[model samples]
Target: MGEKVLSVIPARKGSKGIPRKNVREFGDRPLVGHAIETCRESELIDTVAVTTDSQEIAQIGRRFDADVVIDRPKQLAADEVPLAPVIEHAFAEVDGEFDYVLCHQPTVPLIRPVSVDSGIRAGIQQTADSVVFVVDSTHHYWKQTDDGFEAVSSDRENRQLMEPIYGEIGVFLSHRDLVTRGKRIGGSIEFHTVDHWEGIDIDTYADWQTAESHRSRKQLVYRVTGNDQNGTGHIYRGITLADHLFEHDIVFAVEPNDNIAIDMLEGSNYDYQVFDDNASFVNFIEETSPFVVVNDILDTTADYVTALRAAGSRVVNFEDLGDGTEHADAVINALYEHSNPPENHYYGFKYFCLRGEFRYATQKSEISSVDRIMISFGGIDENNLTARTLQALAELDDQLYVDVVLGLGYADPEQLDPIVEALPDNLQVEINQQVQSMAQRMEQADLLITSNGRTLYEAGSLNLPVLSIAQNAREQKHPYAFVSRGVLSLGQAAYVSEEMIRTAVTDYITDETRRETMRTALADHDIANGIERIKQIVFDETHENR
Candidate 1:
C-alpha cells in the first residue's frame, strides 16, 4: 500500500459555460472554497493538491489552504484534453507517492466532507479500478433510433432488470497505482451512490437556484464571488442578467480593468470586488460548478464547455452568429435568416439580449429648438468625424445649436476637452454613453442624426425623424433607405461633409410634413418587445427537443 493519500482538483483556464465554475458563487462563498474546505475538513486525506493551467485558480487554492498547487501546462487546457494524463503528471511531480487520487471538481459545490470520506473508503474497499459516484435516474429515457421509444425493456420478464442509475455522475475516486498503468479502473469498477440533491452539479441558472436552495436548507457555508474583469464579456453581462432575473440577486464583479466600462458597473448597485487576481477561470468553474452549463460566449473549443459536458453537464447554447459552430445540447437561435433556409444557422439576434419595457410617444414630435438646429450623433463615433461635422455646421449663417451626442467609445478625451470648450455658445455638446435621457433627447430634437447601426433601429423605434449618415462602407448605401422612408434625410455617411449636414438640416427644419410622414410610418408598433419576443421564440424552438 502507498504511504500517503493525494486528492487532485484539475482545473483548466478556458471556460465559456459557467464562466469560472470553480470560482462561481454558491450561497455566499467561492465554489472552489467549498471544495477545498471540504477536503481539508476531511480526516483521511493527508494531502490536497490542485492541478491547474491557470495561475489565478492556484492562488485561490493556496489561499484556501490547499497543501500544494501545481501550475499545469497550457497544452492540456484544450477541449480534447484527458484527465488521466493530468493526474499522472501531477503524481509524477509530487514529492511523495500516493495510492489513490481523488480527482474532485470544485463546481460540484455540495461535495461534503462525508461524501469525500465515503468515496475514499469505497475506493479502498473495491480494490479494483475506481469507485465513482452515480445517481438514480427518475426520468423515463427514450433512446433515439429509426423508431422512437418502444420499450427500454425488450420483454416484461426483463422489466425488473431495467434498474436505472444516472451513471457517470459527480464524485470519482481513482487508485493512482492502477491508473498509472494507463487505465481509469482495474478490471472492475464500483460506485458510491449519492443523493440527487447532494450531487446537484451546477452549470446553468436553474442549477444555481437549486444550489442556493440547498445551501439555505442545509445552512451550508459558502463564499460567493461576483465580480472581476478579465476582458471576457463574462462579468459584464453576468451580473446584469442576474439582476434582471432575480430581485435579490446578489451579484458581484472582481478585479475589473481600469476603464469606464468597469467604472460604469461599479455604480450598478451590485456587490463586487476589484481585488488582485483571485481565481483564474479554471479553478472557479471546477469548484462551484453548475448542472446545466449554458454558454453564449467565448469560443466553442473552450475547455470549460467541453470538460463540463464531458463530465455530464447539460450543455446548452444560444447562438445568433450562425451555424458551423460547435456541438451543444440544445441551440436557440432567433435570427431572421435561420427561419427561411434552416441550415443550422442562427441569423437574427441573441435570445438573452433583453430590451427594456416599451414606452411610446403621445407628443408625436417634440423638436425643442427656438431658432437654432439640433445635431445629434450616436455614443460611439469610432471615427472622430464629429469635429468635422460640427465645423461644417459652424459655417452656416443660421443660428445653429449642434447638440453633439458623445459616445463612450471615442478615445483621447484630452483632444475632446478643448473642442468642447471652444464650441460656439449656440452649439451645445452632451456626453453620456449610458444614454440616460436618450429618449427625451431624441424626441426633443428638431431632426435626429446618427449612425446606420443600432442607433438607426433606436431612432426608428422612437419615431424621431432622422437625418442619417453612414459611418462605414456597409452603411453608406443604406442610410439613404432611412431617407427614402422619410424618417431621415440621408447624407452619404462617408462622402457627406458639414455642407451636407447644414444643407440636410436646413431642409428638415423647413419641412415639417416629411418629419410627420416618417413618424407615422416608423412608430406604427412597439419594437421594444423584440427582446422578449426573441426570448419566447428561442424557448419555443429549443423546448421542442424534449
Candidate 2:
C-alpha cells in the first residue's frame, strides 16, 4: 500500500493575544476552518484532522469537511503546551498508521493546499525525517551587550551581503515516529521556503489584522459619482477600470441621488453602496479600509484625497484635473490632452481606458455616404445637446437618417417627442436607450456625432468617424477629440453655433475623401492593450505592497 499522510491543524480555543482567535472570522471562513479546508484540499494528504479541546473549534473543523476531530485533553490545550505533543496526540487518535505526520497551525490561515502538498512531496523526495516551511528574515537582530546594544551578526553592512536568515513558519512535516518521540527536527530536516506574505502567523491583534488584510487585500474600491445633471461617464469609467481588475474584490461607491449609477451596477458581480454625502462617503471608506481606492469623479480637492489617504488606502484617480492629483499616488487622465503631465500622471490616447467591446472590435465598414448618422451626447445630456443637434440636423437634407442614442439618465423624454414629430416626413429618426451592445450600434453607423466622453474612444476603436462636441467646459480639454484624431470638434455645445454643426455635417457628407481619411486616422492608433497596462499597474502595486 502507498504511504499515508495525516494532516493535523492545531486550533486551541484559549488564545491570549486575541480571544476566540481560532474561531474568529478571517474573510468568509473561521481562522481554524481555513487550515482544515486547506488540509482537506491537499492532494498528498490521505486524512485531514483537527486537535482542539474546545467544541466550537472542532465544530468549525468538521463543518469544513475535516476527516477527524480529536478532542485534546485540557493539559495539552494550555498556552505553553508545545505543538509537537499536540500533533502526536492527534495522530494517536487517528486509526491508521501514517508515514508522514503534518502539523499546520490554524493561525496561519493563508497557507495553501498546493504548498502543503509540495512540502510533503519534498520531504519524501529528500528522504528527510522532517520538513519545515520557512521565510527569509529581512530584519536584523540586536543583542544588548554590557556596553550597549549591538548587531547580532558581524555581516550587518547590507542585507544583500549577509549570508541568510530564515525564520521558521507555521507548517511542519515530520516522520510519525519522530513526532511521537517529541523530536520533530532531531533527524535529517529539509527546508521548504515560502514568501513572507504567505508565511505570516497571526499571534496578536496586529498580526490578525495583517492576516485579515492579506486574506481580503485585493479589494479595489471604485468611488464614482454620476447623475442626470453631470452624466454617467464617471460611472462607466469606474466600471471599465473595475473590469480590468477582475481578480480583485471590486466595489463601486456612488452618491445616493445617482440612480443611473445604481442601474449600471445592478446585477453586477461587484458590490455597490450609496453614501448620502461626502462625509458619509469618507466614513465608509475609512471603515472599509480597502487596499486601493479608484476615484472616477470629475474633480477632487486636496481634502478629499488627504482624508482617503489618512484612512489607509492607496489612491488612484481617473480624469482628475484638480488639486487632488498632487496627493494621489497615481493619476490616469486618458481623455485630457497633455504633452507633459507629472511622472505619476498617465495621459494621452496611449493611456485611454477602452471598453472590452471596443478593444477587440472589428473595423467598422465604410459607407459611400453619411446617410446614417448617430447622434449621442452621453447619459444625461444636461444641456439637452441631443435635442439641439436634432434641431440642426432638421435644417439639413431630409434624406439624412438619424439614430439618437439617449443615456439611461436622460430626464426629458417628453421634450424630445415634439422635436421628433415635427421632423420632415422624409427624415427617419430612431432613439435607443440603455443599449447593451454599444459597439454593435456604433458598428452599424458610418458616422457618430457625440460629446467629449468615453464614447469617443469607443468610436475611434471601431474606426467610426466622429463629429465630437464638448458637453461642458471641462470636457473641452479632451485631447483625443480633435480634427487630427478623425474627430471634428464643434467646441462646447452651449457656445457652438448651430451653423457650425450644420457645416461640419454637410462638409463630411459631401467630402467622401475627407471622411475616408478621418476613418483611416481613427484606425492608426493601438488602444487594444490599454486595459492590460492599467491591470499591470494596479496588480504590481498590490503584489509589491503585499
Q: How many clashing pairs per prediction, in order?
A: 47, 0
- State candidate 1's TM-score: 0.45
Model 1, span 494-517: residue lDDT tens: 677777777776766666666567
| lDDT digits (tens) for residues 1-546 of candidate 2 | 267899888888888889988888888888888888888888989998888899888888778889998999999988888887888788889999899998888878887888888889999988889998998996679999999999878665688778788988889899988988976675899999887878998888898777777675587788887777767777766787777663577888888787777877885555898878778988988998988888888789999999998999988888888899999888887787666678777776766778777766678657577778898887778778888888887777638778888977788677898999988876799997767777888888888999888788889888998998888787888868873558888888788877888888889989889999898898887666677666655544432110
Candidate 1, RMSD to the unseen true structure: 20.5
CA shift at 409, candidate 1, in angstroms? 3.0
TM-score of each: 0.45, 0.63
- What RMSD value applies to candidate 2? 18.9
Q: Which ranges in model 1 have alpha carbons more than 4 Å from their true place? A: 1-240, 247-258, 269-380, 395-400, 412-436, 473-493, 534-546
How does model 2 score by TM-score? 0.63
Q: All candidates' lDDT scores?
A: 0.57, 0.82
